[model samples]
Target: MNDPDRARPETPPGHRGVQYAGRALCWSLAGGMTTAAVDIVLAPGFHAWPVLWPLPWYLTCVSAVAWAVLRAREKAAALRLAADEDLVQGQDWERAA
Candidate 1:
């Protein structure tokens, strides 16, 4: 039987990386907004200090998580490409034998 996945064209890693980056940015924005909302609700008055206090920490955490995810994706793509190359090489060897 023919495989469905083999018929489809593979997306470039850079395109996938862009998608992941966009998703990460969206999630980070949502988290920052939620944090701001909570700060606003809990604080007595509209104080810039309380609302803005978590900005640095939130940014740092988001950057770290995004970086890790992108790095992992890069590594996984590299491994997959290498595996594919190995398979092709093995098939060529088999044909030659």
Candidate 2:
């Protein structure tokens, strides 16, 4: 059977503003921390990154980048959902974008 809730107009989450702000803060801080940790472990050759860095450092950096990338992907998915909701409810797309 079709779901009745599907036809209802969507409302923005009550905490949407704070939730997105928190996500942005966390994303930037985590990305910076990852790069900084790699710089610490790689010592003088961090500028060269995975190229000149030792195997362990390279692996760690790779993992950090992967984590950040995945977080970004999740953020994009969240934004997409918000945008979809906004479209359904006749809201402006600016915030969701």
Pairs clashing within candidate 1: none
| Cα displacement (Å) at residue 65, model 1 | 1.0
TM-score of each: 0.49, 0.37
C-alpha local distance difference test of each model: 0.68, 0.57
For model 1, the superposed segments whose C-alpha errors exceed 4 Å read 1-12, 15-47
lDDT of 1 by residue, 8-96 (tens): 33764665765666566676777777776776777646567665757755775776677677777776876887688678778878977
Question: Which ten residues in a row are the worst by lDDT in model 1?
Answer: 1-10
What digit string (tens of lDDT, one per residue) describes model 2 on residues 1-97? 2236776335333345445545655665665676667668756653566554344444545555665666666667668876776676554345446
Q: Which parts of model 2 have CA positions greater than 4 angstroms off?
A: 1-55, 91-97
In order of listing, the candidates' clash counts read: 0, 0
